[model samples]
Target: MSGIEIIRLPSRFDYSFHRQFGDLYTPLIEGGECDDIILDFSQVEYLDSSALGMMVLLQKKSSVNNIKVKIKGARGATDEILKMANMQKIFEFI
Candidate 1:
């Protein structure tokens, strides 16, 4: 509803960050104070399926709230994994 909310993801993005991730975005989305959400993967080096699943879940929640979600700073194996998962179909990389 106002500006973008940028959430900086942890270096090792996995199921461990699931609850924290949700806590970070849920309030912003529910508050309806932002039109867009940017997930910063700049610090991330490795990620697992659970991380990918978390992203998909975010996308679903964001879409329902009419909020745009984008991923940024993905590189190396992390980037490749995301591409392999066809995450581009669900999230726009920046």
Candidate 2:
């Protein structure tokens, strides 16, 4: 927890995964034990608005806990979506 927690997203990162997404990061953020959280987008093929919202919420939660968040392995359309959403302001790309 003091190091980093990598949450690997799924192929379809949308509303369907909202609950699962929260389950992945909620405890880590709330525990205040982790120093960094890496969202591994390696398997993500698509992400809708809901996914964007989730990311925003996650950032808000982690920031309050002084935890860092980063994104990695985003390519093609997924990367484009993130940029269009101005995710760079909230998440560091690794």
Looking at candidate 2, what is the lDDT of residue 83?
A: 99
**Could you give candidate 1's per-residue lDDT for residues 1-94 as a string of tens digits?**
7889999998999999999999999998899888999999999998999999899998999999899999999999989999999999888999
Among all candidates shown, the one with the greatest lDDT: 2
lDDT of 2 by residue, 1-94 (tens): 5779999999999999999999999989888789999999999999999999999999998988899999999999999999999999889999
lDDT of each: 0.93, 0.94
lDDT of 1: 0.93
Task: Point out the worst 10-residue segment of candidate 1 by lDDT.
Answer: 27-36
How does each model score on TM-score?
Answer: 0.97, 0.96
